[model samples]
Target: MPRPNVWRDSAETTRLWVFDALAGFPLILMLLHLRWWTFGVAVTCFVVFGVLERMGYSVRFALRRLRAIAGGSVKLGQPWWGKRQERL
Candidate 1:
């Protein structure tokens, strides 16, 4: 699924919520019909799963930036930390 522009950064935005709802609708309904407690647990699992995923992405991004710096690849924020972006 494509990430829409408006909801790219927010977890509670209507677009993101709606997309998650539609994607999980069948599983949600099935779990809810099976057992109330199980349905609650499943919803919690899905929401927190995304939180963990976002956290991991951020860590990976930082590591990538550090690796680039160490390799002397210049970037806007770290221009002083490495060689300038250039062509011979």
Candidate 2:
């Protein structure tokens, strides 16, 4: 049997929770600002970012994904903490 992929699993979970919390931040702010459209956009971007992050993608990767959605083709996938440090 193969060893379990614990690192990836934990990374994904952390990414999801981070994005979820980020999404909530804007929503909470919106409650005071009363900007419904901005709130919606924030939520949408949060979900998109969360999905990309959970898929072993970095912030640049998430930005690239958004650019792709906006009709561009830019590839990016560097770990946030740099590749060498990731092994630690």
Candidate of highest TM-score: 2
What are the runs in model 1 whose C-alpha is more than 4 Å off? 1-33, 57-88
Question: Candidate 1 on 1-88: residue-level lDDT in tens?
Answer: 9776995577653333423433354456756589877677667656654564466533234447669889785555655658677788
TM-score of model number 1 = 0.29
Candidate 1 — which pairs collide?
A: none
Q: Tens-digit lDDT track for model 2 on 11-56?
A: 4433344664444555676777777797887678777766766787
- In terms of lDDT, model 2 sits at 0.65
TM-score of each: 0.29, 0.38
Model 2 clash pairs are: none
Query: How many Å off is the CA of 14 in candidate 1?
Result: 23
Q: After aligning candidate 2 to the native by TM-score, how far in Å is the CA of 30 from where it should be?
A: 5.9
